[model samples]
Target: MGSAVRIARETTEQVLAEWGVGPQEPCTGPVLLILSELVANSVRHAAVLSPKVTVIFAGGPDAFAFGVHDRHPYRPALYSPAVAGSGRGLATVMELTLELGGSAVVRGDADEGGKSIWVTLPLRRSGAPGAR
Candidate 1:
């Protein structure tokens, strides 16, 4: 989990820099947090043997999308805070995604026997085209 988190953070930083977004940019922190949660979840609940996790980062002129694919077919579940460590991962990802004027989705591919969670955030306050 720690290694995965570090890789995700480094990848996000590289991407943001490549996008010409400075490290102090407002979205950098939330984006790193979101990536950590998603990657951690993959390591914790979605691992199969060696645990295969694939992360992708892509962006348009005004929005960026990040996703993590794991080798677990089960759909992620959301737990109330009272449930202890049960629900925070997906919930935090969703909350931060919305806070950034973005949204999240998780899909399980039966054929592949795994799932991927994705979040999309706007690049600017004016909003990204087709962002919801």
Candidate 2:
């Protein structure tokens, strides 16, 4: 899972760079963290015989969208953050997305028996009304 997290972080960094976003951006760290959590959760809870997890990253001039797909039908479990160390992945993703003026969503593929969890983070461009 550590390797998975590292790979996710590196991939996310590359994507952000390609999209003209810098590592110093306020949303960069949280976006990387969110990617790590999504990959870790898929590995921990959605593994199967092959245990395939696919990560997708897409960014437009205005926002970035990240997604993780796994070969299982399990939906992410949501829990109170007060709980110790368990069930905080999705919660953290949601919190960070909201802080970045974005959103998170989970979709289950009934026909394919798998799921994809996604988050969108808005970009605060220079000179925009709410730029930061």
Candidate 3:
């Protein structure tokens, strides 16, 4: 799981750089953190049913998006109250995403039994108001 997170972070960093999202960008840290949390959740709860996890990244001039996917059929409730340690992962993802003027959604894979949780954030210029 640690390796999974590290690999995902590194790959995401590369992708973001390719898209011209600098390390100092306001949304960069939250994007990496959200990806980490999502990967961790998949390892912790979905590994039994899904041996492989996929991370998807997409970006445009105005928005950046990513998704974590697994073969587990369970779709978590993103806004549900945290059940001790069980529910905080998606909650944190949701919180940071919404705070950055972003939205998240869960999509089921039609050819498979799993799901993908996708998050999209508006891209603000470095010095813009609320950029940080």
Query: TM per model?
Result: 0.82, 0.84, 0.90
User: All predictions: root-mean-square deviation over Cα?
Assistant: 3.9, 2.8, 1.9
> lDDT by residue for model 1 over 28-110, one digit each (tens)?
77888888888888888767642778988989767788988887777665333542466666777777777778877777777
- Model 3, C-alpha of 122: deviation from truth (Å): 1.2
RMSD of 1: 3.9
Q: Write the per-residue lDDT of candidate 3 for residues 2-110, one digit (tens) a residue.
A: 9999999999999999998888987789889999999999998999999899999888988999999999998887766753356567777888888888999989899
Best by the lDDT measure: 3
Model 3 worst lDDT run, 10 consecutive residues: 79-88
Question: What digit string (tens of lDDT, one per residue) describes model 2 on residues 1-132?
Answer: 788878888988988988877887766777888889889988888776328889988878888998899878766544345523565667777777777888887787778688788788888755566777
**Model 1 lDDT, full chain set:** 0.76
Candidate 3, clashing residue pairs? Answer: none
- Which pairs clash in model 1? none
- For lDDT, candidate 1 versus 3, the one ahead is 3
lDDT at 124 for candidate 1?
A: 60
What lDDT is reached at residue 94 by model 3?
Answer: 84
Ranking 2 against 3 by lDDT, winner: 3
What TM-score does candidate 2 get on C-alpha atoms? 0.84
